[model samples]
Target: MSIRISAVAAEYGRGLRRSLDQVIGQIDEAKRTGVDLLVLPEACLGGYLADLSDADSTLVHDDPGPPELSVAGPELAELAAAAGELVVCLGFCEIADGRRFNSAVCFSGEGVHGVYRKVHQPLAEDSYYSAGSGFAAFDTPVGRLGMLICYDKAFPEAARALALDGAQVIVCMSAWPTSRTGAAANLADDRWTKRFNLFDAARALENQVVLASANQAGRFGTLRFVANAKVVGPGGDVLASTGVDAGAATVDVDVPSELAQARRFMCHLADRRPDTYYPPHSMLSVS
Candidate 1:
């Protein structure tokens, strides 16, 4: 069966209120296009408020009873309301155990589905958030959906695990920096120059799963992110691409077809020889 998804690549560093408003607007557009799911850029709710130059004073606490409903609190409700009959994946700064984490939360017809904390936090992110333990894929009406916050997509293992866990579609949310310099702009676009190829093309080819990515745009305190939002097919085809920064685009995808072709050609998982592949410590030396 074919399904449609709307990917929203927006600039969200202005503030919480403004960012959420934009997200709600995007959701409305997605509904108009009959999208099954809506994916937003990382930190869409909180915005990329924390920078490396400033020391982190933000607090993080684990979900005690119900989720904290202060500033970062109301976004969930708004997201749920906007979702209505659709599934959504929204990113934000998470506070837990006195530490901050770059997290992506998924909301669907049944409310919040799952949350994925970024594992590989970059230099700018490291100062503000702690790393996540592992990866997870959620089962939804639109098939099994895998979650990964920006930076996490850099690692192949993360995507591998999600594929192994039965995820047919992988969605990533990121706030990647774009070129604002004179020399860089003349040569190439910073987004592609910094390596959008490896992330979009390689991931789809390796895992044999459709990859959808949402990125932020515009300048947020010296940092710029021009939207390079894309949807890649299993065979490394660029199914749908958006050149501009802000706007909505919809793509009708066949999840089953991609998965079937990937399995037939690669079959990497089936050919694995796990019994003999042990850790170095477990392999005793015969001296």
Candidate 2:
């Protein structure tokens, strides 16, 4: 009952055609490798912000931000066609009702399974993109899947909500960069990269669910991305990883069986005392 899953670390840019060509090739390769699900880096459809030097600059990059596309756009349809039997999750900038948000969509040949707007924005990201409000899981061919974009994974409640709603596999897409002020000499030693990896492992361990973490790699604008895509087992163990380089990592996992085993002795989710917990949404932004 094990399903093969792959998480990718690669560079994508402003050229829509190039991105599609690369992704389609990846999808075709995954099909050959028997991958049931494929996770792509954030903004793979277009690209991520090039610079964040001035926090309140109100600029996505030196150029225009990645094309604002709708979920119903033809590009996604093209991707869906290529997906065929493989369920794929990837990110992009979404334009809805004249406002733009960071979004991810999961789909297969059957059609779109789910869409998740990133609920958490880091630094001055909110100045460029509007925030999403919630998290939910949806049925997919591989299993019940939940998706998060970039900073969303940094919040425990974001993944926990999906886990509670029956997500067996969680896919997180990011264009995460190295430290803004003080970066490590090596990409591997970068503090931001460590936090990114830690969040992927901790979220899976706490939720008792398998996790596929995909991230952008190489340099984009003024940012140097930390490419460390990986597949983590329910016990927080990284089964496969691309390290700090641009590559894809794959692993076979019997999600349900592993989830059962992880929760067999200590059921973290079931043992929760909601009555004793503080309200999650009580805090408001100071600015």
Candidate 3:
């Protein structure tokens, strides 16, 4: 069975009400387009922080944190209601047990299905939120699904772990920005944007699974986001893309059949040699 999916590359500011309105509008559009799954950028609900710089240790230590909301809060409940039967995956700042986490939540009219806290943090983001312990896949309306937030997709092991656990579709939500040090004259020529696209294709190709990636757009604080939302086929083909702009990339694909075809010749997951794998330093010493 084929399922329609959409990845949104849009800007979300610090206004909670405005952000929620945008999400509802997106859901309305997704429903009209018959989108079974809608993926939104990281921190789409409450918005990410202005700067992630740790240049001044004092400022890093003294800075106020992201706005926190409960996964079971009214915000998510409203989102679930707005989604109706359409499955939606969106990033938010989650507050659980008085602690804040950079989290992504999946839900429908039936309510929340799964939640994933970001495990890998670039720069000094760890100073703001705690890291997630592990990765896991869960059943969703579209397919067996896995989720990765921003920097989590940078690690091959994270996607591999989820694929091994039976994830057929992986959605990566990112608030990725343009170059930090050397600014690019054109946003399209930004190196970070290139890396974002490369990682999405590489991870999908290596895992033999469908990949849907959504990212933030426009500028927020010191960061100019790279809006390159796209859906990649199991064979690492770009099924649909929004390019480097604020829009939605939508595609319809038979995920199971695609996975089967990609793995037919050589199943990357099945062809494993874990026993021979050793630490890099240990391997060098042995050689």
lDDT of 2 by residue, 58-127 (tens): 3544477678889999989999999999999999889999998889999999989999888998887787
Off by over 4 Å in 1: 53-72, 179-183, 186-188, 191-194, 274-287
Give the Cα lDDT of each candidate: 0.73, 0.91, 0.90
Give TM per candidate: 0.85, 0.94, 0.94
* Cα RMSD to the true fold for all candidates: 5.2, 4.5, 2.6
TM-score of 3: 0.94
**Lowest lDDT 10-mer window, candidate 3?**
55-64
Ranking by lDDT: 2, 3, 1
Q: Which candidate number maximizes lDDT?
A: 2
lDDT of 3 by residue, 1-287 (tens): 99999999999887888999999999999999899999999999868877888644435444344568998789899999989999999999888887779999999999888999999998867777777889999998778999999999899999999999999999999999998988687878889988999999999999999999999999876789999999999889999999988999999999999999999989999998886675433445553
List, in order, the clash count of every candidate structure. 7, 0, 0
